[model samples]
Target: MSSKKGGKSKFLSEDLNELLNESQFLKDSVSNKKITKRQKNDVTEEESLAKLIGQYQANSKKKKLDVNVEACKESRQKILDVMNNQLETRKEKSNNLLKNLSEVMVQLEVDCNAMKDNEKKLEHLTGAVVKCMQQATTAHRQKLKVLKDIHASFKKQCEEMEMDHKTETDKLAEELEDDIKKLQEKLISETKRSGWENLRRTIFHAMQNDF
Candidate 1:
């Protein structure tokens, strides 16, 4: 009975050692699983951070493109406005030049008409002067002809008067010479008669004394 009790106690000690070894193995497996799960969670967090960074970069690039497009549109509108203003100014200047040209053309036409009228007047005046000169020359020729006729008539009258004067002088000279010859003959006859009468008277006186 003493040997059998000692063998049973030894058998019980071996069984208790086996249970302790099994419990240690289970604790080691639980620790290894916990470490693997913690590693997986860390990898998932790094992937989520990478996705957020990519989204932020894409949004920034889009905003910059939008700003550049808006600036380009504003610049194009300003250029168009300036070009339109320049075109309007040039159009106004062209209209003013056309108006001035029209005014100049009107004045030139008026001046040309005036010159034509003056030329016609000058031609008329020249014709009138020529006509007057011709009339004056005709009148002067007629006057000269009349003067020459008067001078010839006066010369003929003077010649006739000189001939009548010469004839009257010759008639007076002949009548005076005949009257002087008759007076001389009458004086001679009277003297002879007176001498004969004186002698007869003397003889009569002598005879009366003798008786």
Candidate 2:
């Protein structure tokens, strides 16, 4: 009985020691696994911090680019507005120039028409003057011919009157000369007869006285 008890006690002691050794091994394994998991968690935390910093920098650059693009859009809009205003001004100027040219053309056409009318009037006046001058010349020529004919007739009548007056005076002078000659002969005969009768009377008277 004593030996059996001793053997049983020995067996119990061995089993207790085996169980304590297994407990210790399990504790060590759990401790080692905890350290490995802690190391992995530390590495993951470092990688996460680095990725967050890089993302922050990239976001800042993107915001700056977006601001620059917005400013460019605003500038482009202002330039377009200025160009539109200039185009409108040029169009107005061109329209005014065209209107002025049209007015000038109208005035020139009116002046041309007036000049043509004046020219036609002048031509008519010239023709009237020429016709009047021709009539005046013809009348003057006819008057000169009539005066010449009158002068020739007067000269011929004066010559005929002079010849007739000379012939009548010569005939009267010849008749007067014949009458004077006959009267002179008769007077001489009478004077001689009277003288003979006077001589006879004187002789007869002397004889009577002597007796």
Write down the lDDT of every candidate, Cα atoms only. Answer: 0.50, 0.50
Best by lDDT: 2
Residue 73 lDDT, candidate 2, scale 0-100? 52
TM-score of model 2 (CA atoms): 0.37
- Write one digit per residue (lDDT tens) for candidate 1, span 133-170: 55554565555455446545644554564455446444
Per-residue lDDT value at 77 in model 2: 57
Candidate 2 residues 75-164, lDDT tens each?
555655665565556556655755665565456555555645555555557777656655554554454445445434544444454445
- TM-score of model 1 relative to the true fold? 0.37
TM-scores, in order shown?
A: 0.37, 0.37
Worst 10 residues of 2 by lDDT: 190-199
Shift in Å, residue 83, candidate 1: 3.3
Show pairs that collide, candidate 2.
none
